[model samples]
Target: MQNLQSFASAMSRRLLREAGNLPALSGNDFASSKEIQRPLDVLSQGSGSFSAFPKSNEQITTPSLPESAENVNAANQLSAPVTQSADKESSGSKYSNWIFVLIFPAAILLILVPILVCRKRGNASMGPWRTGLSGQLQKAFVTGVPKLNRPELEAACEDFSNILNTFPTCTVFKGTLSSGVEICVVSTSISSIKDWPRSAETLFRKKIDTLSRVNHKNFVNLIGYCIENQPFMRMMVFEYAPNGTLSDHLHVKVYEHLDWAARMRIIMGMAYCLQYMHHELDPPVAVNDMRSDAIFLTDDYAAKIADVGVWKELADKAKATKEDGSSRSVSPPDLAGNVFCFGALLIEIISGKLPETNDPDCICIWAEEHLKAKSYSTLVDTSLQDHQADELEAICEVIQGCTDPDPMQRPQMRDVTSKLKAILAITPEGAGPRLSPLWWAELELLSMKSN
Candidate 1:
């Protein structure tokens, strides 16, 4: 009985030892499963996070477990690790896709917005621009037409001259005639008239009447005349020229004041006026005495032709005598002679010298001699020494063409206008010669000449 009791006690001790070993092994297996699952979670985070783990650590050992519980636990642990890793990877992918979707469209819009704005601005800036003669003339006329009286006419002329002093432009003032009748007045400084014949007075009135019907920037506006019964006392009020006359200003000293630009402008203005008279008018007005003295200056220094009526009267008187079979006065030449005189004027403009007098030996003859020799430099105004050689040559050629000895060979006023306008079109703005103080000085000079 004593042996049986001792054996039972030994068996009890062995069972307790076995149970203790089983618990230790189960704990080790649980720790091993956790380590394995942790590795899977680390890989699922992202490449950056996974790289942070220590690669040098040794792997831990796991103890064996009972068959049924170990198999079930292992399967669950493995499945949970894989499922968690997949979920983490899908979430990372969704975040990356969301960032891409938000950034790409914003980048495209940033690039395209400035291009659209630039295009819109470009279209807005390119609106209409105006540069036409008819439009400018109409504007000038409208502004000047309303104020036409004796005092208002003089004021207009003075105002026009003042305006020209500020900028290059022309203006006209009309004088009150019969009640509401207003006649145009253009002012300029030209050669003085020593005597006013009865024929001249009649012609002046007739020409004024004719000119009143026309409107142009280049033609003289015949406002009204002040008739004095005494000789050299009559005053014909027209537009005032702030810049004076071409004749007085064309000399070397005076010419320097008129830059090449201003001179060209004067030529262009005169040519256009003549063109209007010869071609544009209904019964083509003939400028029988076209001398530089007859060409007036506007406030802007543009040429406004004067003395249209004086020659018309002379022509009419000559015609009347020829019809009546009476002895004619020592008359001037006909229309052909007028063209010849105009040619002389053109030569004077280029050479900056007075036309040859009735004396056969004149400046025109001298210029003609030099012109035939192709010594064009001698023909140009010495004040224009710095101007373009090519331009000077072209102008000389035109002058020579206009001043041809034969009237038939000379270019008509229309052709003259066209050529001058072409030259102006090509010339750079402000490229002409500077205006001279001599232009203004001429007012005193005219007063002196009158005395």
Candidate 2:
């Protein structure tokens, strides 16, 4: 009994010393110490007094107790690292979140800054029109319509002071390129167009696109275009026609009078052009200004139409429509209007008189009456000689059909082309040798074949 008490006292003192050295105790440790004290106090009270140590040792004991302070200390040591590991994991997750938040925006800035730098550089090189004329127009200028440098064009056209002819909408300037090829530069003042300050690029792009697609021998060749700033200008470059316009030859007498064969060829070419524009092209093109003045003559008197698909009138019409709030979109060019004008052109060609000089409405009427009376001479140009009567009658018949007031009553250009071809076949060449002897010989052979 004495040995047991001594052993208990020594064990209790050692446990108390260790508990005092501990840095701090958790709530669980404090509660566990209290639980040990209840049993120890019960024993101490029951035994009438054991030795009291410090306050920490007072709460716990070892030797006589089955649940010892030493065992609780061992369990606390095992559990301490696990709680610290959970705290470390939580701190690591927070640190990773901060890194991600910082890195994402930095990555975005790295991507965006270079693009902005490149865009600034590009704007510096290409000028103000670069952004306005990007995408399809930029691609078109590169691949389809050659973009002539404005400075080079200015030098060629003598700073555009060498004017060839002036019209209400545009001015023509004759220039010889550096390569010694003669070119006609047509300049239209876009400054006059409504809302041009805002829509200059779009208007020019649309106009140039319309002009560029006309690929035919009978239409003036679109060589290139120029757009410049600081006294801004928009110009189209064309192959210069040495013989000038049909109006120059026929009305103004700038050149010698056209012979019967030449007139026939011009008529035939104009017919074919109408056919090509009105039927052959996917979306049929309409000529806004279909006058004799619009026709150019090559060195060989081959008729090539100028300003075939370009007009400021379209923009004006669109502006008018917009002002009235009548339409959000521009209406398509009136193909029937061209048909009516073509009839007037045919009348002008035959009579050698301006339809505008006579009653424009009555011009078709009188020409039709002359055709009906078989008075072909009255309808024929006084300048034209040796033209076949059948050819005149046939052409006047086409004019009558074209000039019908009702648009639906007018014949398609395809049909007009066919009729003109039939007339051309029957009519013999006058004043010039036949165009192709072999072709003519074949025609003669075919004529001999059937009724």
TM-score of each: 0.45, 0.59
In model 1, which runs have C-alpha deviations exceeding 4 angstroms? 1-204, 225-236, 252-256, 308-338, 356-361, 426-451
Clashes of each: 19, 0
TM accuracy, model 1 = 0.45
Q: What is the C-alpha lDDT profile of model 2 across 39-158, one tens digit per residue?
A: 222212111122223444446342232366675676567646654665576567557666877897899999999999977755443332231222222223432345666776777789
Query: In terms of TM-score, how similar is model 2 to the real structure?
Result: 0.59
Instruction: Tell me how candidate 2 scores on lDDT.
Output: 0.63
What CA root-mean-square deviation does each model show from the true structure? 23.9, 22.5
Worst 10 residues of 1 by lDDT: 127-136
Q: By lDDT, who's the top model here?
A: 2
